[model samples]
Every structure is written in structure tokens, then in C-alpha cells.
Target: MAREITGFSNPLVKRVRSLREKKLRKREGLFLAEGLRILTEARELGVLPEMIFLASGADPHPLASALINAVEAAGGDVIFTTPDILGKMSGKDNAQTLIGVYRDRLTPLPALDRARAPIWFVAQAMRDPGNLGTLMRIGDAVGAGGVILVDDCVDPFSVEAVRASMGAIFTQTIAHASWDEFLAWLRAGPGQLIGTSLNTDQDYQAPAYVPPAFLLIGNEARGLPAGYEAACDLLVKIPMLGRADSLNASVAGAVMAYEVLNQLRRTGDQGTAPQAPE
Candidate 1:
């Protein structure tokens, strides 16, 4: 059903607005994604938000119409509101005309399909939402299975992270697990865990990456812990040509991810080399 909302006093408005907070999002099991383009991407990818808020006076576009039709077809609710109320819901004065409230669907570590794609990105103890979003974008770029967060990290579904993902949040699979859980799951599968580290003497480009390579990126300022680095199947380093000690976490991840992606694509990823016939 469609309803027109004239006031910001509605509990739904406040409820969507509070999704920007971690605690509120945790309790509600919902997250807010604002912007017509992002929601359209979701729609095209078959993800319809449970509830949609549209600006009552906004100009119509074909994509927007498509999104509305798709949402309604999926038995989703559509609420028409003023731009001001829309802004309140988005925590922005110049918010987009469209906003979506989606239920958070977290992929548990055990449920992750190891062979969904050739590349997978893993982040540990990451705190920055923008960095987290960039990681998701990288995963989407390389056609990765997903981006997995190891240990405590930023909430990927947060408004900032989702906005920064620029719609890749819907394209890329997002999952979470503790260090122990992730290690056990990866070991039980046919995947290689590769970590980006400064302590390694191996250049990032020198190694042959296995398919389903799990690219591990550490905290922004701290890199990977010594123990975590030791657990990796391989450790490689991006050389520093300038005065900077290292690249940014997301930048480093892109470099490593692309190198492995190119390798896998070029070699056709024959898996581990077979032992020579006896």
C-alpha cells in the first residue's frame, strides 16, 4: 500500500533516521540506503527494499518508475514524503528524493560460498566506514565472491559505508566472523589466505595467486598482527617508492586484489600444479 506522510513526527521517519547508529541498527535489524541510483541498482539486481520513501513532488524518471513498480510488485510499502522529511530520514539536508529501508542480511562465515567467485577480500579490525566501502567496491570490481570482515570492525551496512560503496554494497556479498571462526572456515575449504604485510620480503607481484584467493587487509594504522600474518598461506608486500611508509589500506587492497585477479584470469587458474608423473 502507498501512503502520504505529511509530518516528520511519524515513528517510521524517526526509526529510519536512527539506522545511522550502530546500536539502533543492531536492535532494529534494518539499515537505510538513500539515493535513487543506489536503490535502482538494488532493484536491477533483484533486491527490493522492504519499505521505500519517495519525495512527493520529485520529478519522475524511468528508472525511478521501474524501482517503484518492482518494490510494489514485491509487496513492499511505499511512503510519499516531503523533501524535508526525506532529509531527516537520511541525516542530510540535501538528501536524495528516494530512500530505502532494507532488512540487514548478514552472511555468516560458514554459509559463505567459497567458489562463488575467484577473488575474496578479507578485512581485519577495520574501523573506517569509507575504507570498508572502498573494499566492497574493490570486491565488486574484481568479481569477487564477497568481502568478509574478520574480528571486530566497522558496520558495513551503516549509511556512510553504504553510501560510499556507491551501490557496490548490493553487488558484493558482505559477511562477518571472528578471527577463530574465519580461520577455521577458510582452512576447511579449498582457498588460499593471502595477507598484505610490510614485514614480508616477497613483492606483491612475484607470486602466483591461487583461485579463490582470500586477500587479507589489516587495520588502517596497525596493519596485520604478527600472529595473523603468520597464519596466512602467503604474505606479500607492495613496494614503497616514495617517502610514505605504506599505501592506504584500501589502496593496498586494490593493488593486491588486482594483481591476483589478473593472475587468475591470465593463467585460467588451473588450481594447484599437479605433481609430475612418476
Candidate 2:
């Protein structure tokens, strides 16, 4: 049975609202996933939240009911609250009918499967949560082995980023490491580290990316850090046809990541490449 929460001062409600701040999220080691789709995805991925919130008076669809049952079976709590409270929890004018408080799932570098033709997407100092989320979605789309965050990147668990990921957050393996630590890992032989840069003469599509390719992307404004290109096994660039100097960080990462998939497909190398679009 779902418990009713009527007051805005409820501790669970306040904790869910506090997740909007990075500090609180980090301190509590929890994050929120809003909407039926995201929570369903989480359940499908076997990631049951610590608790779930349902808007009072909201229609109880079969799927929603199933989720509630599943949460109860898993020894998790489900709270039914007023629409206003749900809205406040979600930080939206029109709150979702369902929201989940999931534990942080970020893993250490050792948790990544380095033996498989491990194709990874590495982002350095990424500032945009939306872009990071989009890259996570793209990484999942292309069958990337995992995503590695280098240095001080935006919180991948942020509400904006998680929403942008469209549920990839639950499915994808995420890791964090410093630049040097990342370099050490690369040298340990997970695969080639491919960097993207405007200064490079090589077209992104030209290379036949070997298995275990790490597609390294830079910050939105700074691009790759200075002197870092030399560390990459290969440096490639996306050609610009229009007057635009560069592509968005996520856009650029998507283009290169797909190209890696394309090259793997052309070579008939399974190498963890996603199925070619039909």
C-alpha cells in the first residue's frame, strides 16, 4: 500500500526537493528521476529507487501500478502526495505523475570492462549537463562500452542531464578520473585514445577505429586542453562546410562516435559496435 504524504514539510518530500542542488545530491548520494518513462526505464534496468513518489489524484495507469507493486516487492517505499508537493519535488510547474529517488550509480575505473573491444566516450571538463546527458544517450545508442568523465565535468546525475539522457543514465556505465589517471588507464591497454580537434588535418571518417577505441571530446569553449593532443593515438577533425567554427560538444561527440561505429561496421568487426541503422 502506498503511504499518503500531505504536508510540504515531510522529510522525504524535502529530501527529494533538496536533490536539485549538486551539493545536497552529493552529500546524500541520491538523485531524482522524474516521469513514468524514466522510472519505468530504471525498473527495467533493475535499478529500483530508494523511494518513489506518486502525485495524488493522478490517474493510476496499469504501468504505474506495476511500478508501485514492484517497488513494494523490492522493499522500497512509495509515497502518494498532492500535486503541489510533487511539483515542488520535481521543480516543475507541472510535475510528473511519478518520480524516483535513486542512489548514485557512478562506478570506479576498475568496474569498467576493459577486456571487450571497449569503445568508450571520454569528456574533459564538460560544463553542460544537457550535452553530457546527450552524449550518454548517444554512447548507449552506439553501444559504447562506457562513459568516462575527466577532471571537473558537470554532474552526470543532474536533473537536466538525466532528463536529457532519456533513461540512458540507468543503462550506461559511468566513471570519473583525472587527466593523468585517464592517461594511465589508456596506457594500460584498453584501446586507442582518439582525440577530436580543429587543428588536425585528418577527417574524422577517414580512420578505421580499432576495437577499444576511446573517443575523447573536449570542453564546449576550450576544446581539448593544450598539449593533450600529443597523448592521443590519433587526432581527427570534423570538416566545417558552413561559416560555423565548430559544433556543439555533444554534436561533435555524436558525429565522431557514430563514425567509429560506421568504421567498425564497414570492417565487419563486431567490436562492440551497435547494429547499423537499417
- All candidates' lDDT scores? 0.85, 0.86
What value does the lDDT take at residue 39 in candidate 2? 88
Candidate 2 regions exceeding 4 Å error are 116-118, 273-278
- Tens digit per residue, CA lDDT, model 2, 1-278: 47999998988788889999999999999998888988898888788888999876757888788899999998998898888898999887867568999999888886677655446889999999999999989988888866899989999999999999999998778999999988887787658889988878999877778878888989999999767888998999899999988899999989988888877777777565545455
Clashing pairs in 2: none
Span of 10 residues, lowest total lDDT, candidate 1? 269-278
List RMSD in Å for every model shown: 4.7, 1.5
Model 1 Cα lDDT, one tens digit per residue, 1-278: 68889887998888888888999999989888888889998888889999999887756688888887888889999888888898888777966569999988688777888877778899999999999988888877777777999988999999889988899898887889989888988999798899988798999899888888999999998889999999999999899988987788889889998898778657767333222112
